[model samples]
Target: MADIKHFDPDAALETTLRLFWRQGPEATGIQDVVSATGLSRSSLYATFGGKHDLYLAALQRYVEQRSEPTFQRLAEDERGLLAIADFFSELVTARCTGPFARWGCMVANAHAATQNLTAQNADTQVRAILDRHHQQLCQALTQALTTARSLGQLAPGTTPRSTAEVLALLAYGINLRSRNGADAHALNQTMQTALNALTPSRR
Candidate 1:
């Protein structure tokens, strides 16, 4: 007789996502997934394949739910430098105070664990996530800075592509720092100081 499966895989994945988000795959083991998902080891293996597969799914979910919408909004926004500033400001606020507080970004966190991940699939997925994040930031900054330049918001000799690269690195830095429990105020101040260099001489 075929045994009926009683667990919700979607619900299980959500639980898995939270666990992986908090501790990351390097520290989180198969037993931790079983514990967090309330599933038997066999059930997890049968349903999700393995921890790496489960993490890949969870990472895709994170990008779809957490990153894509925000990037889209920021990219389309006409607020230029204010949009960029607001992006970092919101990141600090959410990272420090929200329900997902201290979770950092799964994509950014993945970079640190790349040296330890053995699976090619895991490496590919992590690289894809990072690349998508970089391209999105570049797109948003390009849109915003095009406007900033038109409005004289950028200083003379400002280069949009190079500046966006710097800001993207800043975004990744904030994600890692917030995961370590950095103060939101200090993070925001750090972000503002970075942005100040791009400001017009008047500000």
Candidate 2:
């Protein structure tokens, strides 16, 4: 007879997600997932395939649960540049000192990691996540720039397309720096300089 599954799959998946998020795939192993999720090897393989499969599932979970909502909020926000500022401020604060401090974003971490990642198609998935991130940032920035231009806040002839690309890359920099121990104040100063450049100069 087949063994009946007693544990909660969603809860187990979340536990695994936290483990992978904190330690990353190169540093994490099947033993870590087993310890974090309290699942037997047979059960884990039966339900989630293997370590590589579980990592992929965890990454997808991070994108859906953590990443999508924030991006949606930024894209829909009507606060223009202030919205972008809030995003950077909140991003660095969370990265430097929050409940989830120093974890760096999973997608960003994956992009930056140089160690052995044995998962199949991980590079392709990372590219997909980054491409999605870029598109979402561009959408949010374009909206904000249109509003700022309408209100005469943008300098003459500033292009939203290019500016959004710069800010998107800037955000990636913030993520990487924060992961490497950058302080929140310093990160905010960097954000301010970027925002100030985006604004029209005083006469």
Question: 1-203 in candidate 1: lDDT tens per residue?
Answer: 98778989999998998888889889999999988888999999888898888888888788888888888888788878898899899999989997999989887888777879887877887788778877987877777777788878899999888898888899899999999989999999999999898987873
Q: In candidate 2, what residue range of length 10 has the lowest lDDT sum?
A: 111-120
Q: What is the TM-score of each predicted model, taking all chains together? A: 0.91, 0.90
The clash tally of candidate 2 reads: 0
Off by over 4 Å in 2: 1-3, 114-120
Which lDDT values do the candidates have, in the order given? 0.87, 0.81
Q: Distance from true position, residue 13, model 1, in Å? A: 1.3
Q: Which pairs of residues collide in model 1?
A: none
Model 1 C-alpha RMSD vs. true structure (Å) is: 2.0
